[model samples]
Target: MSCNAASAAGPRIVSMNVCSDQLVLSLADPDQILGLSRCSRAAGQPGPAAKARTSPRLSGGAEDVLLLKPDLVVVSLFDKRATRDLLKAHGLSLVEFTVPRTLDEVKDQIRAMGDVLQHPQRAQADIARLDAAVAQVRAVASAHHYRVLPLERRGFVAGDSSLISSLLAATGLTNAAGELGLGAGGFASLEAIVQLRPDFILVSEAGNHAEDEGRAFLLHPALERFYPEGKRIVLPERLTVCGGVMLADALDRLTEELKRVTR
Candidate 1:
């Protein structure tokens, strides 16, 4: 259905992707949500996942979505194209969101989704909350100007153009990945990471525990030596993965983590 044709109270929506699930949960009225993706209810998940628990969940299948007879379906760029195609072919109105890499882009998405959901006032309120939270982080971050790197699983470093990098900037930290010559992000060699010696290594988790090979990179001997304990800041993956209402929490968490490490 076209945006003009959507109900003023908002369309009955089905979110087929985790990120979209969060957006819908945050922006849409509870009754407007027809169904949410199964991942939105995963154990220990953060952000809007909790709100998804009582809602109906889709199996990430076109048939399941079709059964709901939703007025609109939300997905992300990362979702399977065939599934999107199948839904579109069957005459479902769809909104596919791209991964946002900056605060401005994130706001644009919030506003866009708000427009689609017919909740412009709620979207503006969310944007205001997000701005206030970011300002709070920026206030503390502007003082120290630390050099930080968002070192992720499998040795990947988030570059200057990434959402993590944008968040780092908002928090008054420099993305060490830019210094290492990575623009959009890439795998940094162990030796290169060691040589850069950033003031702190921002990770999704702390401690020496490694859940898998990808996570093992964060626990590497070299990293441990350079960024032991207090030298690392853990932001939790859920906060950083997608841009939406959760970002307000993410920015607040960054500020707190920065304070913890800097102290």
Candidate 2:
């Protein structure tokens, strides 16, 4: 399964989830990637998005995957159960992953994918890359203690147990969601958001304009009055939506944003 073989002897891989798509695109050799799920196109990070476009897009159905005849099919635990059973019935090898909720899981996943792909070098490289970001985040967190509420569409919060919260806590930001009885995450009313009174609310995008009802909830006048441009930290949804190699870059972006706001 080594990617080093001159004739590309590595496993032909089809990734079923956008998150696994990112990992596969990063760790697997180009020839090893047989297909990527359509989710990657709309929600994956820009880097993975670009690569995915050049590769074949797949439906969740077993038909397309059967055509590819991939040696290994990378999937998420969240993928459709029927699809997985169909693939298994055909004797296709499958590797499943769950969402990483902590830095430890993050590291474990990279290493695991590397082993699964038989590309140890690629996995180690990704881990090394993430470790540098981890160090930077830890350094910043150690310096200051700010409370940050990870606010999302419809005022839903990412609880303290989330991967992003772990990343935030490493940088010394307290998860304000906990104070509002959202340790495991739940929606908050506009009034509840204002009253909770955190130092900042981390969002997936910038602006206070409403594109739809969900967006409108976040753009409510009450939120804008308190958490304006300088107050709302915009971390792109691509990075935070999935826990993968993209998070290393996300961590760097957060460090810069934190520095700017703290100053």
Candidate 3:
């Protein structure tokens, strides 16, 4: 938790956000993990570093994190300001990372984390794998004719600067929402979505499946009616939430669905 820089090199690290928790755990040694957020250990949720979470878990909060005595703490912009301020007040060395909206931003974040962690090799390897996956999807999609609409109704649709939009472009799929001129993350009206009339619909396979809650705009009755006969792609939130190795996994699923729907 507190170490002079002279002796702090390669100090223990803790991640406070789910996405960052996963990424840091993936890149760090097991002994290097000080603790993780509470959400990381939840069953059936995309979570903290798998290895670190396999044993007992650490609760995510300023007090819990301070108790761990980590050398560096990775916090996301999405984390509460109070949590961050408390940790800083405790004299913990912290690095704040922005939630990436575009693919470039995602890659940049990965590399930046890699740089901070001194694990450039691991980061490079992951990025290379992602690049290969994107290329593979693009090749297969180019020969096909059907386009895709990266739809998310759990509140918002993928728009101009989002990672979903970046991946759609990488895979050679067209995004109908952007064509309709929606700006960013938030609810998209049903009428606006139907007017786009995309060739296929992509919806979250997980999250609250309720039609009335956080992402209900994507699950509106009108959407079902509009795309009843078209292809549908169901994706897990983690894949599209942040860009990382899991993205390739999501894209593979996407490529398979796109091929099926297009055929």
Candidate 4:
């Protein structure tokens, strides 16, 4: 469905997850965002996920969502089913999308959500802008020779099929983790990481606790012995969690840090 046609009535959208938060906020105008989940809001900033919090804060319950009187509710499949049931009971229109695992999935979700919001044109434009930003960063990476290792101690780092891994490849860096035979998901052993010896580490800030554990792994006696100081890089999970314009931000930070190390 093309967003070229103008709709007199725009849907009031409520986003329930971080990935959805990025998509819903980007495509909808301020007035269209009826509510945003509290998880989207990060430290000190008005939700790292949402561009701006024009929507009412949703605390994962049906009570406040009912108050929004939304025309459309967007949710993640992983979110509590009780919330979905409650919203549906009120006869509100609903759309659900799985967390994106590939860049193509990101684009598909954008287009799909845009169609639902009656603003496909805006979604196309936003996606184009996001693509351009990714290309810009990729151009810079094309000129360099960097080995990237997606780091996750508690969970396995991104692999060949993962979105984060695709983003790393998008920037022209080789993911050493994939090279050393870690498949598409979950925790990695310290010894395996040592064997990879990546030129740079792409640690995803899954959350504060996960980020802390990842950071601590860097300082572990075994890991430290393997990787010299100053070779590790920690990137906020938001940047790599989903394919968005923010990827350029991650590339900029990663490239800068990698350059410093290689220099």
List candidate 1 stretches off by more than 4 Å: 1-8
* Candidate 3 ranges with C-alpha deviation above 4 Å: 1-9, 47-49, 144-146, 206-222
lDDT of 2 at 44: 39
Clashes of each: 0, 2, 7, 4
lDDT of 1 by residue, 1-263 (tens): 56555575679899887777778889998888999987888874554655688799888889989988899899887889999999999998899899999988989989999998889888899999999988898787778778998898899998988998887776677898999899989999999999999999988887777889999988888889889989998888988788898989988888898778777
lDDT per residue as tens, model 2, 105-153 = 8889989998887898888898888888878877776666788899999
> Which regions of candidate 4 are displaced past 4 Å?
1-6, 44-51, 143-145, 205-214
RMSD list, candidates in order: 2.2, 2.5, 3.4, 4.3
Choose the strongest candidate by TM-score: 1
* TM-scores for the candidates: 0.93, 0.92, 0.84, 0.82
Write down the TM-score for model 3: 0.84
What overall lDDT goes with each candidate model? 0.86, 0.84, 0.71, 0.70
Query: Whole-model lDDT, candidate 1?
Result: 0.86
Candidate 2 positional error at 217, Å: 2.2
lDDT-wise, the better of 1 and 4 is 1
The TM-score between candidate 1 and the true structure equals: 0.93
